[model samples]
Target: MSFDIRPAVPPDAAAACEVLRRSITECCVQDHQNDPDILAAWLGNKHPAMVASWFESPTNYSLVAVRGDDIVGVSLLTGAGKLALCYLLPEAQRQGAGSALLRRLERQAIELGMKTLYLHSTATAEGFFAAHGYRRDGNVRSPYGVETILFWKPLAEGAEPESKRKRFCNCNSA
Candidate 1:
């Protein structure tokens, strides 16, 4: 299905959070052995507040993928180009929504003068990120007991200069 990727507004915060909550619960949590408690805690926890704040912050960039009136996917990028969150509803997976969201975020990162984009990928998403040019830097444990692979990629050449961008987490600055 075709979708439109656009900058998120305040009203879209709730919809974006729902998309994120659903994606994590149904998609990411499955690799964790279908633990409903863990999924609920992760998705039902302070996510709404955090997402609302992100949408309101000047340094945090967020995007939503919309199919008509539905928010099918959401992603957030920090000032330093850290890809803090990327999620698509299960029904929307593999339909270009996630890729479209990523591309839109990458374009924003370039416009913000960022050189590299980083994210911590779940076991299910690591391969996806790797295929998209994000190489694993290391494995890390999330607060919920799941281990994630840290991945990062330098944007296309001539997009931005690495020397000017801040490093994310333990990722190599050079």
Candidate 2:
């Protein structure tokens, strides 16, 4: 029932991937419709080795939510403040783990001087992100045909997000 979130080391990649895969396969049934082939295709590029490599890469910052020695949820934030990955196992859902993981990622983004945080949320997770104040910008179809919501939340309170701001260019002939 208790869990802690922490920066992920390379060795945690396998467990993190397991958490992610279980979330996708079990918790996101509506997105994949219980199609094994679709799930396989969705996970083909997300091998544990690739997850480990991402942990070693400078472009990504990964985090894991652990209960005891087991990872219950996982997330990876990119250098650009994009939440490139996030998921919680079925057992971890609705227990404050996902929200805590997101809050941790947002804190890290703010520490990195990011103005906003963005993520593509699966249909199953859209409400979760929305509840945390992420605004829906649009929708996108994944390469494998899963529909996702493009969402972003401003890190600094009351600041106008650049993506939602109006721009005017003045042009005059002198």
Candidate 3:
């Protein structure tokens, strides 16, 4: 199904929050493992009020993907170049909504003069981010018990990536 991506408004908070909550609890089974405690911790702050606050923040750029009158995905980018939140309903996966939302955020970041965009991706989304040119920075365990992969993408054209500047090769390989 096709999705329309647009800037999120205050009225979108409730649906956006629902998307976030359902995406995590249902689609992120690999990360949360259906553990009640972990799910609670992960979703503790994912409420409509908080989502509305994010939409209202001057430093944040938020977007929602809508299929008809229903919101199927949501994303947020911070002024500091963090892709803070990106979520889609379980039914919306693999339908290009996530990719479209991510690409739009990347474009906005570039337009805003951001040099790089970074995000912590769950195991469920690691491959997706990598496929979109994000490089692995490292990993860290979240408070909710999932080990998330740290990924970053350079947004500037012709920028020298750190990986290209340094290389380690075993002498015996030659």
Candidate 4:
């Protein structure tokens, strides 16, 4: 099925929340590993109310990938150039929905005059981000205790030279 990427609306909160929850629960087994505690911590704030707040936040730019009536993926970017959230349903994985959402957000960031785009990527998504021109800067332990890779990409030519970009070590330690 063909998918379309569009700006997320407040009414889309519940569907987006479901996509995020399912994508993490099913598609990210390598990260969560069925650890009950880890899963609970990670999904603790993924409620529809919280998701709606994100969609309505002026500092956030959110989008949803849809196939007809179903939301297949959800993405959000902060005004400060952080690709805060990117999740796709298991059925939508490897089907171009993620890429579409990424490209659209990148464009949005550039239009907003952002020179770089950065995110904390799960192990499952590291290679995907690398393939899309994001460089691995370091690793960090997430609040939920997962080791996530930090990735960043320059949004435009002459934005920031790699040599000048700050590189950090693993932040898993105190």
Candidate 5:
């Protein structure tokens, strides 16, 4: 399907949240070991306000993938080069949406002059990130009892001069 990827606006907050909620509950539940409470806390209760606030932050780069009017995926990258969140509806999986979102974030990070990128990947997504050039740095315990594996990629120097480029290769599919 054709999709339009663009910077997220304030009105896209609800759609982004919904995408995240559904993605976590439906696609990530197995990784959470079928724990409803953990799922609820992780997706809903733990930091709903914070998540919403992220969309409104100038320092946070939020992007949405929209197939016409439907928001199929969302990703957030902080100024620190940390990949804070990435979620796509199940129907959007394996269709290049996630990869597109990640690439956009990587570009944003490079524009911000960041030299590295990192994320905490769920069990189901560890392989995906690994295949995309992120190296596992070990597991970290989340509040919901889900232990996420840390992954990171460093930008290759000389790939782009610091002054003119707004994108860099993290060595993932580049």
Candidate 6:
């Protein structure tokens, strides 16, 4: 199936949140182990209302991959160069959606004049980030005692001399 990757909007929050919740619960079982408290605490900030707020936040950039009417994947990037979120439904895994979403965020980062990008990956997603050129930068314990792997990668070379909004961003799509 083909997926259309586009910037997220407030109206997309509820559906996007479903993909987030389902992906985290089913795909990250290795990290959470079906622990109720951990899941609650981990998902506490993921409420649908909160997700909607992110769509309007000036300092954040979010994207979604839609297949027909379903939101199959989602990603969020902060002005501080953090990849705050990246999740895809089980059925969408292994396709190019994740890579496309990530590449778009990296391009947006370069356009925003960011030289470095970082994120904390769940145990289940460590390989995905590593495969995208993110390195092991450090480790941080989540509030639930899960060891999240911190990763960072330098944005591509050539910071064009132009306005931030119009800068030329040549992000790699590999």
The predictions' CA RMSDs to the true structure, in order, are: 4.6, 8.1, 8.4, 4.0, 7.2, 7.4
Task: Give per-residue CA lDDT, model 5, range 1-174, as digits (tens).
Answer: 777889987778777778887888889966777788787667654144555677788878989999989999988887766687788998898999889988888888887878878777889788788988887776777656787877787766633222332222221110
Q: Per-residue lDDT tens digits of candidate 3, residues 19-123?
A: 989999998999999999989978888888888888998989999999999999999998767788889999999999999999999999999988887777899
For candidate 3, the clash count comes to: 0
Return the top candidate by TM-score: 4
Task: Give the alpha-carbon lDDT of every model.
Answer: 0.75, 0.78, 0.84, 0.85, 0.75, 0.81
Name the lDDT value of residue 171 in candidate 1. 18
TM-scores for all candidates?
0.84, 0.88, 0.89, 0.91, 0.85, 0.88
Instruction: State the lDDT of candidate 1 residue by residue for 123-145, as single tens digits.
Output: 98887798888877777766665
Candidate 6: the clashing residue pairs are none
Error of 6 at 167 (Å): 30
Candidate 1 versus the native: TM-score? Answer: 0.84
Q: What is the TM-score (0 to 1) of candidate 2? A: 0.88
List, in order, the clash count of every candidate structure.
Answer: 0, 0, 0, 0, 0, 0
Quote the positional error of residue 44 for candidate 3 in Å.
0.3
* Model 2, span 25-130: residue lDDT tens: 8889999998878787677766678788878778778888999878998888887667878788898888888888888888889999888877777899888899
Candidate 3 residue runs with Cα over 4 Å from true position:
158-174
Cα lDDT tens digits, model 4, 3-119, are 999999999999999998998899888998999998897888888988999899898899999998999999999876778888999988999999999999999998898988888
Candidate 1's displacement at residue 131, Å, is: 1.4
Instruction: Give per-residue lDDT, candidate 6, residue 150.
Output: 73
lDDT of 6 by residue, 47-67 (tens): 678888887789889999988
Model 5 ranges off by over 4 Å = 45-50, 158-174
User: After superposition, which runs of candidate 2 have C-alpha atoms over 4 Å from their true positions?
Assistant: 157-174
